[model samples]
Each structure stands twice: as C-alpha cells, then as structure tokens.
Target: MSTSSNRQMKLAAYVMAGPVSGHHGGWRYPSAQHDILDVRFYQNIGRLLEDGKFDMMFVPDIQALPRRLGDSLASQLTHGALGALRLDPMLVLTAIAASTQRLGVAATISTSYFAPFHIARSLATLDHLSAGRAAWNIVTSFQDAEARNFGLKEQLSRDERYDRADEFVEVACKLWDSWHDDALMWDRATPQFADPSRVAPIDHHGRWFDVEGPLNVSRPPQGRPVFVQAGASERGKDFAAKWAEVIFVTHSSLASAQAFYQDIKERARSFGRDPDQVNVLLGMVPVVGETESIAKDKQALLDDLCDPEAGLSTLSYQLDVDLSPFPQDQVLPDLEVGGVQGHYREVAELTRKQNLSLREIGKRYGVGPLRDFNGTGGEVAGRMQEWFDARACDGFMVQMPYLPGGIEDFVRLVVPELQTRKVFRADYTGTTLREHLGLDRPAH
Candidate 1:
C-alpha cells in the first residue's frame, strides 16, 4: 500500500446484469457485452474486480420487474432499447465467489417479501462460501408487481415495510448469533461435527415474522456479513444508522450529498455508534474513455440508443406516474409522487436545478445524468477526489456504463490514476468486506 493513500477514501463497484447500464439505452452500445445469465460472465467480472483492487462488487437483486410498464410485461421486456434487465444477484455472486480469492461479494435481498430465517441462512451461507467476504444490501421491494408475486394484492405501506424490515434484520442478527463462532468443532478423531449445545434456535416471534432456531450455516468467518442499506427517507436513515455498515446514497449535486452524509452520520452518533462505522458510498455511473472527447462522444452515442417509450415506461414504474401520454420532448413537472425516496427525488431535483425540459428529463432517464461521472480517466478521477474531499461521501459505488467494457475501462484507466493519486488502493489489505472498509472485525 502507498503511504499517501492511508488517509484517502475507498471505493467499491456494483455489477448488475443483462442490462445494468446507467442510462436507459446503455446496453445497446456496440462495445457492451451481455449473456450475464451465464455463470462465467460473473466469474470474469469478479476476477476483474479482484484485479482492480476494488473493495467489493455488489449485485443488487429485485424479485420482480416493472410489470407496470404496460398491461403486460412485454413492453418492459421488449424495451431492449432501454437498459433494465437484472439477473438474480445472489446466484451470480456465488459464481463470482468461486473465481476470486479476496474480492468481497454483496447482493441485495428485499426484506418485504423474504422471511427472516431464509435471509439469514442464505446470507450466512454466502459468507461461508466466499470465506468471510460477503455483504448484504438490505432492501424493501417497492413495486406492486413484486407484492403480487408474493401472493399479495399490493405492497405494504412504506412505514409498515420499514417496520417489517427492522424486525427482519433483528431476527437475522439473532439467528446469526444463535450459532456462536466456536459452535463448530470439526473433531475428526471424535467424529463430532459440531457442538450441539453451542447451536441454539432463535425462537423469534416478531410482529412481521415468526422464525425459530439457528441458521443451518455456521457463523461466517466475519461473524455476520457486512450490513448495507439504501433508503433516503427519514425512516430509512434511522434504519441505516442502526444497522448499515455501508450506506449507498445517490444525489445529483455535491451539496445534496454533503447534507445527506452529515445528517446520516449525526444520526448514527445519536444512536451511540461511531459515525465513521457506517461508510457513506455515493453511487456514480461512470462513462469513461481514453480521451475526454472520445468519452463524451461515446456517451452521446450511448444516449442515442434510448427509446422514448421505454424510458417513459421505466419512469412510470419508478415514479408510479405514466408519462407516455406526454410528448417525449416535454419536460416533466412535479405532478406525481411515488416510489422510494433515494434517487427518484434526486432525478426530479436535477430537472429543476438544471432547468431541464421534460424531454431532457426523459432523456436523462434513458441516459442518466442526475448522478453520473463521464470523462477521460483524469477528469473522472478528479471529480471523485473532489467529492471525497468535500466530505460528500467516504467512497463511491462504481456503476458500469457497459458490461465488461464499462468495468474494464475503469479498472484499466481510472484505477491506475486513482492509485497514483493515492486516493484508491493498489492492493487489498484484508480479505473480508468489513476489514477492507476499515471496520473492526467482530469478536469471535
């Protein structure tokens, strides 16, 4: 490690597949590769993350797609012009785990639809499979389609969802604790697989769920996988303060980022926790090229691929308001309110702040501008440093502009610059996500 980088911040990458481009039409770029459903795709991505010295590559999963796109899921599915497909992040993470040694793997699972025990076992097992390098991006499924898939007519109210999430995480912690660190004693001589007394059932009966007993997997090497949360509402902040080790935040401007960062850290302090214990990571969708002009040109080309129908469809699903009737070039007003509060509000704020027309805002969805970094390696690195210095965030969640190439560009060009500037690591100092984040490892 470089001495100069000791005081600098850290960074992580987040990879979602089929079409995880920051902009609506990102995946359509000639250079962008797909077939992410294949296990090898993730393995390759993982090896790149490990080679790049990234803290981790988080994969966010959602139980349902934007069924609200139209009367059927076909428009959303056919919106290939729009970048909006996601594979099951957990299964992909497992493939990644097998290919890398030290890179941490994190995946999102919704607390709204999943049982606490189920979450506990799956995450703990992942931590074990990855040898202590796993992170869980705790989330609540927001779409009504997701609710229906769980055999419900509608999603729970926001407050109720968060309430259930609180209890869900609480139960997960208990189950993780149920199997003490030394609970397993693989004594070949005595033929004892594990200490039965050490493993006890949680017997948790909460308002939202009833889970009993210990997780099938033993306590992971890191004790519990690193907890991550991303909600921007008031209740969401409180939840983050209580449980999140890494808080993924999205804001269009530096001012907004600083405000949210300070507010969440102060809230953590009020919770009797070290504010620094939670690493605030800003999500930045990066589009980079060898030269500034080349990068901008590439971005423009990618932007051209957007389908107005597709973009509006996505916006409808996200904002819960259909803009299809509105002219594609028209500007969106603050006419409707919907969805979770993190990035949606930021998108609205971006239009007002930049005096963007409705068409411009819709274009923004197709090729996101509310929160992204686009430039040559040097330019991109400088912007990241500025955000870090401003105390706007402790780190960044690198969102790929294109598969493989998007990630490859950052690693090959931006990573070196960042390392030379001593703002990012050139080698990993530890194996687990928590250790890499500089958090104290839990007592065994």
Candidate 2:
C-alpha cells in the first residue's frame, strides 16, 4: 500500500463503561463480559489497547437513562440499551490509567452540569495522577433527562448551550492556568513551599460563570489536559475550532468524512489555530475476522442479536423525540429536534437516501453504523489506509461491536497491518497526551 505524508495515524478506542459501547446487541454476545463494575475489566481493556499501541482510550459518559420513548425506560432496561447503565467515565478512565503506562486516558465530562473549577480540578488531578496522560472530552449535554438530574426542567436551547459552553471552557482554561509552572518551590534551606508571586487567582467573570481563584492543585504535568470534542453542528464546530485539540466525528461515507475534515480544519485555521494541530478522528466500527466470510458471519450474528426496540429507544433519547408514535413501516418525518442535531442529521440522511422505514432504520441502528472495515485484517487496514491517504480523517476512533473481544480482535489483526504499512506508529514515542498528538502545551 502506498503511504500518505510521513504523518502516522492517531487511533483512539472509543469506549463506555456500560454493557453497550455503540452496538445495542454487544452485551448479548457470547464472549462479551458483563462485569462492567469491576475495575479489572477496564484495566484489562487498558492493557489490551496499550499492548496494541493505541494512542488513547476514550470513554464517553451519559448521566441519565433513556426515557424519551413513551417516557418509559422499559425497552432500554430490558435490552441493555446504550444508556441503560453507565459509570462515571472519569473514574473508569482513572482505573485504566492506573494499569496502562503509555495509553492516554480521555473522559467525557459535560460542561452543562459542572462548574469550571470542579472540572478543572478533576482533570488536573487526573493529569497529575496519570503523569500527564490525560484528556477531557468537552460536552454540552443535550438530554432533558440529564438536565432534570441537576434540577432543571429541561435542557437549554442548542445555541444557548453552546454559548454557555464557550464561556465554561474560558473559565476552565483560566483555572487550569491559575498555577504557573514555577509556582511549586521545595527549597529545604529556605523552608519555602511555593513562590507566591508565580501563583495568582484567575478572577474570571463571565456571563455564565464567575470564579475567583487559583486551582489548589499544582500546574498539571501537561500544563493543561488535552481537550477533546465531538461537536458536529455549526456552532459546535466553531466551539471545537477554538478549543478542541482532538475532534471526534461520525460519518457514513468517505465523501462526508472528507467534507467534515476539510470544514473543521478550515474553521480551526480561521480561529488563528494551526489546522494540523487539530486532529479529526472519524468514528469507525470494525468487525474483523480471520476471513471475509467469518467477518460477515460475525456481523450477521450481531444483527440477529439486536433488539430493534432498544435501538429505537436509544435513538429517541438522542433525538429527544418519541419514535413509538411513528409507524414502524413509515419513513421518519423530518422534524426540528432539541437533542443531538448531528446524529439526527445522519439518521435523516439514511432515511432519505435509502427510503428506509423506521423499522429498517431501527434494526440497522441497533447494529451500529454500517462500516467499510468488516473483513480480514488486511482488508480493514487497506480501507483505513485509503481514508488516511485521502485526508478523510487524521485517524479513527474505533468503536467496538463487543467489549474486550472486539478490541482484542482489532489489536491482533488490523494494528499489525497498519504498522507494517508505516501509516501508524509501531510504538508510543511520547509520555503526555499532547505529545502523543504532536500538540504543543499551552502557555500559562
């Protein structure tokens, strides 16, 4: 395979601490582990990803259960839907960080419900504990169920949420910058603990938040944890352009992925940021096997195991619309949604392009996004190399169909092929997450 620019692909394992990662039927797989609450389960995953030389392990979080369909959680609970059960991503990532030495740990923490100081402190602590291998996935949660958990009647409008998020990040950056690198002084002769002149309060006053103070923790080893985001809306893209170092995105085709990649890079440049510094990672679901037929059978099995209602329920929650009212045989009508606009757009495109009914979409959604990388290791690696060469993405955020096994398969099969092709690293060369991504640490 012909190589692209000496730039190596950056791979991150998109994961969740729930039974379901992306595929609703994943937990039902015979080899899938159900011991999600066990830290060892996550640690094993960490070691597996590190063993494969993945750049990072990313964990996405949801604070509440799926209740958008008929205002009931029965379908979700019964089928073990995506959001049926979730643990705190930060805590899960910490466990992973403890077991793995080189793999970076990224945790999703919503800006909507958390104060700037709280998030800054938590991420800084994680960065320190992990010895600089830390990243924060910034999210402005769109679910009303999530808002309700924090005593709000409903979520703010999309624009409003983005506005708040912009300010929220501003405050967080200030807090993270509160402590200078030279603030800590352990001079035994002078008996001085820290240099007071080097440390100062942020004294940030914004429309959304007002915080006065320096972070209690010392400056993180990374200076600041790497910022990750998955915003596909126009406003969301702008926010990402301004702040996100790693951009996670989902696309159904190479053309779509290319469009987003170019658009985001342009947006980053417009924001006075180097486009190359912003890594755009496309979400990919890899169903691999020793042979193409075996891979097909594995995919078919996942499809057979899927509960359509579980997919619809999770979809409903994502779109903030009840799918139960829509006829299963009819095409989903275009409607203004208050939830994840990007996801809604993807679903709508699928319906329009294929003229698919709600039932058809549900079954497909339950199996997760249809991927081009479902074959033998060589085939999967070839397709990935194609995307990388085409500049469709900086790399991929691999979403597994099943837990440990799914990741285990890719690591064993595809990783070696990519390494041989010289499009991916054979080993980690950096300690900090920023260094892994080739991003410079922000100046305090």
Candidate 3:
C-alpha cells in the first residue's frame, strides 16, 4: 500500500449483466448495447475496463424477478427496471475472466440462500480460473421475493440475517483454509499426489451451518477471494468492518460520505484490523460531456426517458412494501420495512429534507444515485480528487447511466484527467485484485 501522502484512488466499475443498471431508462438509450445475453458483450467490457486501468469490475445479482409492486411484474418488465431480466453474475464474470488478464472480476453471492461449502468451492474455482483476480460481494438476500425462491415463505429479519451471515462467512473461511498452500505435489518421480496429512477436514459446527471435511477444491491463489460488501445499516456496518476489503457505498453528500468513512474505519480498528486495508468506495454516476451544458443536456435526456412506475416498482421491492396504493403527489409516509433498512433510511431522509412527494422521489430514484458530479471530464475529475483528498472515500465505484457508452465516455474523458493529476493509476502495477486495491492477501 502507498503511504498516506501519496495514496492513489482505487477505481471499480459497478455493473449488472442485464438491461438496467441503476437507471431504469438506460436500455432505451440509443447508444447502449442490447446484446446483454452474449458473452462477447461482457468480454468487451472486461477488456475496456482493463484498458482504462480500472481496479475491478463488480457485478451485483438478484435471485428472483421483481414482483413486489401491485403483485405484478408489468412495471419492471415493460420499463426494464433492475431485476426484470437478470443473468447469473458468476457465469458472466467467469466469461470475462477468460478474456481479461488484469481486470478483477467480482460477483455477488448471498449468504442467506447459499451453503458455505457451495460459495467456498465456487469462489475458489473462480480464483484459480482468474489467476487470483476474483472477489465476492457479500449480501444477505434482502428481498422476500428472493427468500420465496429458496423455499422460504419470507426473508429473515435484519439482525437474524446478519447473525447467520457472520457464521456463514466464518464457515467459508474455514473451508478455504482446510488445505495447506504447499499440500500439492506435482512431482511424478515421487509417484504421489497431494499430501494427505497436509489436507485435513474442518470440523465446523455452528448455529447456521454444520459442515465437515475439507472443500473439494484446492486453496485459492489469493488464499481467499477478496471480500467486497455494501452494508449501510448499523448491523450492516459492523459486518462490513469485520469482513469487507472493498466497501461499496452510496451517499448523497460529501459530509455523509466522510461520516461513513470515519465510522467504518473506526469500526475496523475496534475489530483489530488496519483501517488502511478497508477501502471505502462511494457509488457515483458520472455523466460526461465536452462542456458542462452538454453534460446537463445528456442527464436531462436520461431523466426524461425514465418511467416513474418503474422506479416505484424497484423501490417497492427494495423496501418490501407495496408503494402502488400510496398517493403519488402526497408526501411519502414513514413506514417500518424489513428490506434494506439503509436504503429506506436514505430515501426517507431525502423526502423529509426536500418535502418531496412520492412521485418526485420515485422519478429521482429511477435516475439512480444523486448525480453530484456531472460536467466536463476535467470538472468530474476535480470533484473526485476533492473527495479522495478530503478522505470522504478511498475511491469511486463508477455506476453507469448506460452501458458501453457510459463506460466509454468516462474512460475516454475523465480517466486521462485523473491520471494527469496522479491521483489514479496510469497503468496496473499489480496482478491480483488484492494487489490492485493495495490490500494484504490473507494467510491460510
């Protein structure tokens, strides 16, 4: 890791292998790519991000379609809201790994739905395939729709889910450490395979799981895949502090970001971890243009194309409440929700501060995170540098307003400005995701 005086920003591309990103209207954008199902589309993305010197390309996933609002999938399907048509993230990331050399590939996996052995084996295999460029974004499946798909009637409560997740990750780490790094023996003259004594069973018995024996896969190249997380609630923050290496987060202002940054770092210190190793990345949508006015015009065009119902549908699924019955023009009422309490708090705070109606909030949410940095390439880089210098974030998770075009614009425009300022990498100096992010590899 670089010293405090010369720390560089870590950049990651937050993406989905689906029509929608954070913006519901993205797919309709004329310049956006439509062949999402093709593996070549993702391979091209991997190559583009690698060429841009991005640290990683992280893909978020959902297990089920959005059917929370009005008990129908029409709004999500018709408008291409997120989760309407999603592919398995791991499969898409595996394809990207085959085509790229240095770009890190991360896929979201839920601890609530999957067994520890399954996650450990899958990520171990990915680490080997990518040559140590794999990361796992940990999430406790928030939506009830996801729970139903896993043979449960509803999702677990917030605290309960985290409790299980804490155990879940523990078991996975144990499984990964079951085999010693030097266990393998490729020498044919010895006429022996891996040393049996060096590989032993991890007799783990916990409240959430009971797994015995070693993982079927060998130890990963990184020892363990780098941990990525985006938990914002009180319990969630504690979990991130304990386990997350690359922390993805969203905030409406610099002050909020700074507060979160400080809190998480302090929490990590309390957990006996080095704060520098916990990299906090703020989620940002950068709409680039040659001039500031052109950028505003581009953002306006995106907002105009948005379908309000689509945003409400996504919000409903996220909050686990049917927002369709509420009056659109009236102030949004506060309601206790079970899904993603942090998201609910953010949206609720926005409504209170702005006196925004349900209709206004929905429209804003559809456009994705608040576009706090939208201008010319130099202007956008200036804002990013300000945040990095102020310790508001270690970096930015570049969320695209549209696919290839949005990514292309940032790489062509803002990246050069950042490189010129020497605040971001001009070229990759490391091979693994851990190295790219300046994190220490975990010992087995």
Candidate 4:
C-alpha cells in the first residue's frame, strides 16, 4: 500500500436503522440486530464506531415508507422490507452524542421538504449539544411519499427542486452565520448576554423562501456543522461544489469513481473553493472475514437473502417509476423521473450498457454493491488502500449489510490491518469531527 504520511483516509459508519440497511433481508441474518427498536443497540453502534476511529456515524433517514408497486404497508412489514423509515434521526443522534466523546453523529434531513429555519435550528442545537461533533447530511428527497407529506401534489421539476435547494442552502447558511462567534457577550454587570452589533438579521428574500434571521441559536461549534451533501447529478455536483464540505457518492466502478472525484474537486476549485477541502467518500459494502473463503461465504449468504418481490417494490420508489406495471422480461423503461437525478442516470446507464430487463434490474437492485469487497481483513484493507492511492476517493462510507456483526468484524479485523499499514488512525487524535476528518474549522 502506498501510505502517505499526510493523507490519511477518512472512514465513516453508514446505517439506515430502519428495517434493513443495505441487504433486503439483513435484519433476518442471525447476527444482525433483530430487536432494532432498542435504544441501547443504537448507542453501542455509535460508541463502537468511535472506538474504531471513524470520522462519523450517519443515520440516513427517509421521511416516509418505501411505497412501490402499490405494495401495501402490511406487505412490507410482513416481509421485513423497508418496514419503516420515518424515525426522527435527530433524537437518535442526540442520544449518540451523549454516549460517544469523539464520534460525529449526523442526521439526513431533506432540503426539498423542510423549511430552512427548521433545519438551521435543529442542526445547530445538535452541534452545540454534541460539542461540535455533529454533521448534517443534506438530501433532496426522491420519495413521492415525502412530497405528499409536505402537501405537494407531486415533486417539483428537477431544475425547480435544485433551484429551491440552492436558495434553501443559502437561507440556512445565512441563519447559521447570523450569530457571530462573539455574539455571546455573557457580561453579568452589563446584563447584555449578547452583542446586538455582532448578531444581525439576514432578511433573505429568494425565489423559494423568505426568511428574516438571526437564528434563535448562537453560532454552532463548527460554524454551521460540517456541511455534507450526497447528490452526484450535474446540478447536484454544482450544488455540492458550492457548499458541501463532505460528499457521499455512489459509483459503479473505480474508474468512474475516480472520474467523479476529479470532476467534483475541479468543480469546487472553479467555485473558488479549495478542492482538497472537499472530501468525496464513496459508499461501499465490505463483506469481511479472517479468510477469503469465509468472506465470500459471508457475502453469498447476504446475496441469497435477496427477495426479488421486495426488491422490485423498493426499486419503484428509488427509481421514482412504477416498475410494477412493466413486464418482467421487458427492457427497463426510461422514465423521465424528477427525483434523484444521479441515481436515475445510474440505473438508466445500467440498462443502456447491457439492455437489462426489469427482472434483471430488480435483481441488481436487491444486490446493490457499490464498489463492494469480499476477502480477508488484510485483502479488504488492501483494496481500500488501492482505491485511496488510485485517487478514486478520499475515503469510504462503509455501508453495513447487517448490523453489529458486520461492524464488529470490520473494526476487529480490517481496522487492525489498516492501522498496521499506517493508513488509518489507531486512536482519535482530534476532538471535533472536522479535526478528525483533517478539515479546518470554519472561521468566524
């Protein structure tokens, strides 16, 4: 492994904490968390990730159930397929904050649906409560179920949604920045707890929203907790380049990932931002064990649990198209979806490359391996080092196929191998998440 002394790879624990995280039947796996409703399980996972020297533990939330192909909620629950995705990530994240000293806990909240003020206040509160170890995963929701909940008849056009999101972010940034670092005077004699000059109103009037600030909360610890974006479409990339400090990405191959990494960094530079400041983390699944054979078997067991029916149902909502209406053997239809432009392109490209049928695509959905790995701990770590050396990504969002077991295996096995190579941290050297991720804290 080409280990650079200055450039250590960042790693994060990615979890959904719904019914199944990555695998369709992951919750059914013997070692996976069957009683996921327990609060202790969530806390343990966060603490474990901190023990492993992870940058952050992210809870990717969905405001609504994954409804597809007219699949009833009962059917989904019965099959343990996307049973429920609406748990408030903020509540869980706060609990995680209390337990772990260094682990950054993040929540996925939709920019498309939420009022900018709400996002600003809640995330700021988290940053304060966590003592700066907080992150916000910005997502433009792709679910029609989410749109319905927001009282929208249908999703906005792609251009419109991005436009609104751009302004949404603008509003949020204004709110976050409204309270200056020195705003909290805390002078008992003067009885002026805050300096009015330092705290000013950002009367922002934009295309999507109108907001008058000074936020109720003071400046967040990291000055608008580490901004994370997970969009990869052309417009999404532009948005990320402008504001995202960390980007979560999905690419089918290393070359594509590398291409994406280079492009996004270049885009950031074009926007007058330091390219190196933008960390691109690829989403990947690592099925690991002590030996290669053991690892492959572990992966196979997860793959075998693929339920095509549930997969198809899940795909419909993901692709934002009703795949249930299409014939099983028919070539996957090209739908002009208004959501998740990047994912839509990925799926569209998949069909275009191989002329895959709906059934095949559904199977592929059940098996979502974005730059997956199956090998011994050393081998898995080796692959990761190669990708890092190749400049495919700054690090990885290690997507767990099943709970606790997959995490325990990776931390126990792969982390030691990585530490031996001196490519990953053995113990946290920084207190805040930005420091751990090698990012400079935003100046006041």
Candidate 5:
C-alpha cells in the first residue's frame, strides 16, 4: 500500500509442539528441552515470541508418524531424527493463548479428515477464548497412514482433496456467519437472551459433507478466525486465493518466490478479492550468531545431525513416490510423482539443475539448508530486507532451526537491526492478529 522503502515486513513463528524441532535431530541439541508433555514449555515459547514483538506463532499438526523412508517408524523415533512425539496442536495453542495476551495463536487441522461442523465449532470457540487472536491453518492431510487411520484405503487424489476442501471452507464460513454479531442479547431486565431471528441454520449439502448448522458456539470476535493455508501446488494456490487470508509457502530461490507472490496476488485479483488482504509468507530457516563465523559453526552443528535416509524418504512421501526401493546413488527418475505437484516440480528442477543423485538429495534434506540465513545480526537482517524489498514475499515464517536457542538468536541479534532500519516494528501496535497484520476485521 506504500512505497518500497517505507513498508515494514511482517513475521510469524512456525513451530510444531513435538519432541524435536528445527532439523531431524534438533531435539537432541544440548540446549533443547525434552519436556514436550509439559504445559510450561509451550507457554514459555508463546511469551518469547510475544516479547520479540512477533505478529503470530502458529503450530502445524501431523496426525501420524509421517514415516516413509529408512526401515521403520521405530528407527526415526529411536534416533529422534524427526518430530519424536506428537501432541494436539490445538491443546498446546490454547495453553499458549492463556499465557500470552496479544500474540496470535494458530493451530492446524485437516479439513480432509475432520467434519466441517467439528472444525467450525472448535475454531469459533477458540477465537472467543483467545479474544480475537486466534487463527486456523487449514490442511488437507496428506499422509497415507492418517488416511488408513480414518478407515480409508487411500488418500483422495489432489484434485478431489481440494474440491472437498473448497466445500469444507464453504461450510465453515456459513457456520461462522450463521449467528450475527448482535445475535446475543444479555438484556436481563426483560429476561431476554439471544435473538432467534439473528441466527439461522445453514442447511449445507455438498459433495464432501452435509452439515445442518447453527454452530453451537457464538460468532467469533474476528467474525471468522484468520484462515491460513500452506499449499504451493497449482490447485493449492488457486484454492488459497479464495479462502486463505495468510498463505504459507516453501520455495528454494528468490526468483520462484517472486513468481509465486505475483501469481497468488493476481489469482486473488481474478477472484474479485483485494490482493493486499492476502499475505504470502515464505518459510525461512535462519542460523544467526554474534559473528558470521559463529553462525556458520551453528549451521555445521545441525548439518551433522541431518539424517539423509530419513530426509530422502520424507521427500519421497511429499513427492508421493516410493524411494525406499532405490539405491542411495540412484538418480531420481523423471517420472511424475503424485501428492504435491509443486513440491515434485521444485525438486525435479533442482535435481536436473544440480544433476543430484538420490544420495545427494537425501543428505540435503534437513542438513543441506533450505532458506539458510547464516551470518551476524546485521548480515542476516540485511538479507531479509532484500527479500521484503524485492517483493519476493510479504513476510516470513521463521522456522527456528532449534528451540529456544534458534528463536533467541533472531530475537536478540537480528530483530533490533531490523527495527533500526525501520523495516520491522519495535513494539506491537495492535491487539488482534488481523489488526497486527494490517488486515481489516471482517464485516457481517
């Protein structure tokens, strides 16, 4: 909305309240805490993010042990190579919300798996509890294991999943809208309660679901909780354009990021929505230190713990191909992979460009460094400004490589530098997540 030099970039923290964070074995770090079961551990993170003046802290949920490579789930669990244990992200987010007043609390749930009414009611209730600072990260669960758990033989095809997601969101929105803002009347003088005319049942019949709604919860303070989606595929992008207020992406290069930023905005425009309302946030993993050399050393620390076999297998799952049968040195075949087409396309291009073998790809998984920011405070801050100024992304979801240490480094070292440059806020100027992100509250 303003000149390039004057605009301030937004930042959110992406976390998973699992046993490990950052790289595969990040929980094994000397400084990393092992108390995943404790409520205090999560509250502390919420406070830290709030102190950093971060716009939001969002946690994604994985329903199952998303294992694809190496030998078994036991191997990865034994090594703590990936997220070791799972907790309900919603439960953790509520704990965070109870502790932090202003910080945005976001949690993910699968639209593909959960009933629309269930999600709509849950998020609405959370929004009320969080006092308008709640957000929902809508996901169409991709794990075959999760599908099996739901008593399905296979995951729906990508198109089918998105179609169902479209309907899922439709139903949720209707439920959220079923009760008007003034529907509740606490006029005790006349012994009156909610006005019935202000609430209507949404008789929704769709290909994916049928929900007779009037969600049990009241309308949320935010009108609807902020809708966040992280899907970079073509179908994913289009679906995001219409329903997502915040879109998360994974891109290897600035050029591709810029292309995505432009495309999503244009796609939003074509949908008769203001493009500015949609924030496209890229996932960034930064390793910051007091000095450039120190940062590189920290980067080396994670690289050593990277589990190539585990990483490659996970990649295979993302690409929807079974790489388990292939040799380490076998070249990734040019055959089309299913699941996430965007991920497949990005990796295919990388493989061709670098002529990388499966072994090389595997090692690069958590170890190789995706969006690495390795340098001193000033050096790292300058790089982030370049991306923001270049319009490559609206902002970043800082994927902290470790736990408190990863978060502390950026907040202590890099944040001040950004504030000094007038490219990031020193203090929060708003209360609700929408106001913090410069988005308007939804109108009834």
Candidate 6:
C-alpha cells in the first residue's frame, strides 16, 4: 500500500439511540436503551466521539412521527426506535456540548417547518455556545407525519420543499451576514455596545418566506455553522451544489456512490463552485469486535435480539408501501410511488437489485449494516478504503447500530486499525469543524 497522508479525507459519526435505526425492532436489545430521552447517555456519547478524535457527531431529527399507521408503537418497539421518543436534537447537542470540548455538534432541523429567523438564531447560538464547533444538517423531512403536526393538511411535495429550503438557506445566510466581522464593540470605559453601522437588515422577500432585518445574534465563530445538506433527489443535488459544504448521501454499491459523487461535484462546478467545497459523505453502519469472527458473533447477538416482524413494519414506512400486502415470496412490484425521496428510493433500489425476499429483506433491515456498508473491523476498514480510493466518498457518516455500544466498539477497535494503516487520522489537529474537514473557513 502506498503510504501517503490523505489530509483531505474527513470522518463523522451519527447517533440515534434505540433498538435500531430506521428499522423498528433493534431497540429491545438488553444492551439497547430505548429511553434516549436520558441526557447522560447522549452526553457520554459526545465524550466518546471527542476521545476517539472523530470530526463530529451529526444527529438527524424529524419534525413528526410518520409511522403510526404502518407500524404502531408495538411494531416500533420491536424493530427500531423512532424520533418521537428521542430527545430534541437541539437539546441533545446542548447536553453534549456542555460535557465535551472540540467535538463538533450538528443537528437536523427542517427548513419546511421553521422560519428563517428562528432557524438562524438557534443555530447561530449553538455555534457561539460551542465556540465555533457546530454544524447544521439542512433537511426538508419526507414523512407526512411531520406535516400534520406543523398544521399542514398534507406534506409539501419534495420539489416544493426543496424550493422553500433553498430560499430558507439563502435568507439564513443573509441574516448571518447582517452582523459584520466587528459588529460587537465592548469597550470597558467607553461602554458604546454595538457599532450600529455594522448591523444591516437582510430585507428578504421570497415566495416561500419573508424575513426583515438582522438576526438577533451576531455572526458565528466559523462565520456560518458549517452548512451540511442531505437529500439525494435531483432537486436535492442541485440545492446541495448551490449551498452545501458537506453532502450526506446513501448508496448500496461503490458504482452508485461514485456516480452520485461525480454528478454532484460536476453540478457544483457548473455553479462556479469548487468541487472540493462540497464534501461527499456516505452513510454507513459498523459492527465491531476484537476480531472479525468476534464481531460476527457480536452481530449475531444483536440479530438474535431482533424482531423480524417489527423490522418489516419499519421497512414498510421507509419503502412507503405496506410489505404485508405482498406475499413473502412474491416479487416487489415496480410501482411509481413519488412522495418520499432520497433514502426511500435507496432502500427500494437495494431490495430490487439484490432480489431479496420479504423475509430476507426484513432480517437484514435493522441488522448490522442498516443503510450502507456493514462488516467486522478489517472488512469494514477495507471496504471504507475502497470507497475512498474510488473517490466514492470524501468520508463516512457512521450511524450507530445501537446506543453507546455501537459507537464505542468502532471507536475502540476499527479506528485504531485504520489509523495504523494510515487510512484514518490518529489525532484531530484543528479546532472548528471546517478546519477538521480541511475546508477553508469562510470570511463573511
């Protein structure tokens, strides 16, 4: 293997505490704690990532619970834990920030439901509170359960949501820029607070939203909390190309990942943006143990704990079609269902490509690799390296298979191996998330 330090590659971890991720049943594990409402658990996870020298921990949030119809709590209890039972991502980030230093905290807050001013202040405060170590995962949630709670009779279509998000982001950026570099002047003797000249109103008026004037807070330490966007639809890619500093994506194969990566970078270039400005990150789940065999054994323990029926229910919501309607051995129909985008298509594509049976698909649902690649230490690291070498991803956005245990093992086992191989870093040399990701901090 050629020994060259790949300084540009970045890595981040995702945390969703419960039985499993999108799959419904994994949380019932004795080791798994469904009560993610606990602040201490999240705080510990934050501490662990910092110790592991990981770039950041991104917490994905949904505005509402979507699966009450497909799978009741009984089904949810079996397969995975939904967002309804978890701590508000913002609160969790605050808890995590208080307990650690250096680890960047990023939370998903939807653009569809929130106003530009509200979103701007909340994220800016987090950036200031975390001392510039903050990021925002810009998402327009897909589930309709989110819409009802926000008082909408129906969910906005994906394209409309993206349109709103584009404007939301633009307004947010203008608001962040309202306060210039030296807006605050706390001269002890003089006591003239802020320079009024530096403060300017954005005066934004768009079709989706209208906001007037400067944000209540000043510009964050990193200028704007590192802009991260996650959506894999065509409209999503365009939005990401225009505004995203980091793009979170899902792909079943290396070819798919590379294709998506190349397309997005090309799109970014067409917009007169540096391709390097958009970091492509593949979402993956890692199951680790002392050895590959041990890891398999550990995964078996998790699998044994899984409820296949619950897994199916969760899959139903993700695929947005009731799997129970189809026979166990019947092939899935190639229906043109359009509401949900991104990961929904990804899951459907994987099932069709692999020709997986209903039972087979359910079994693998919340098991080991929830979204992307899954394996033991050596195998996982090898696959990760393959993606990196193929230019499929700039890094991996690791989603935990369980609570602290899932993330704990990867940090302890796989990280050391990857570091020794020189494929991953041994220490974090920078302070802010942008610095850690090797992106230049914007000056605005």
Where in model 1 is the C-alpha error above 4 Å? Answer: 1-5, 70-74, 81-84, 325-329, 370-372
Per-residue CA lDDT of model 5 for 1-444, tens digit only, reads 567776778899988787545566467667777777899988988898998899899897766675666436754566665534678988899899899999998888998888989888888888898898999998887767678778898889888889999999889999999999999999999877989999999998878788888988889999998989987678888889988889988777889889989999999999999998899888778888898888888777777767676567557656656777877787788766666666676677678778888888877665523544668989988998888888988888888878878888889999999999999988988888998888878887
lDDT of each: 0.80, 0.89, 0.90, 0.81, 0.81, 0.75
How close to the true structure is residue 289 of candidate 5, measured as C-alpha lDDT? Answer: 89
Compared with the true structure, what per-residue lDDT tens digits does model 4 show for residues 346-438? 677778877888787766666674635668889889999999888999888898778888889889988999899888888989888888887
Model 4 deviation from native, Cα RMSD in Å: 2.3
Tens digit of lDDT per residue, candidate 3, span 111-227? 999999999999999999999999999999788889999999988988999999999999999998999998898779987788888898999998889999699888999999999
lDDT of 6 at 409: 78
Clashing pairs in 4: none
Q: Write down the lDDT that model 4 would get.
A: 0.81
- Candidate 5 has what TM-score? 0.96
lDDT of 3: 0.90
Better of 1 and 4 by lDDT: 4
Candidate 2 local Cα displacement, residue 161, angstroms: 0.9
Lowest-lDDT window of 10 residues in candidate 2? Answer: 1-10
- Each model's number of backbone clashes? 9, 0, 0, 0, 1, 8
- lDDT accuracy of residue 224 in candidate 2: 90
| Alpha carbon lDDT at 85, candidate 5 | 65
- Per-residue accuracy of model 2 over 1-444 as CA lDDT, tens digit each: 223568889999988888788688889988999899899999999999999999899999877987888999898899999888899998998888889889999999999998989999999999999999999999998899999999999888889999999998888888888888988999999988999998889988888998998889889999899999988788889999999999998877788889888999999999999998899998888999999999999989988899889889888998888889999999999888888877887788789889989998888787876568789999999999999889999999999999999999999999999999999889888888888889989988
For model 6, state the Cα shift of residue 247 in Å: 1.4
| Clash pairs detected, candidate 3 | none
Of candidate 4, the 10-residue stretch with the lowest lDDT total is 77-86
Candidate 2 accuracy as TM-score: 0.98
List the pairs of residues colliding in candidate 2.
none
In model 6, residue pairs whose N, Cα or C atoms come closer than 3 Å (at least 3 residues apart or on different chains), thus clashing, are: 19-26, 19-27, 24-79, 24-80, 25-78, 25-79, 25-80, 26-79
Candidate 6 yields a Cα-based lDDT of: 0.75
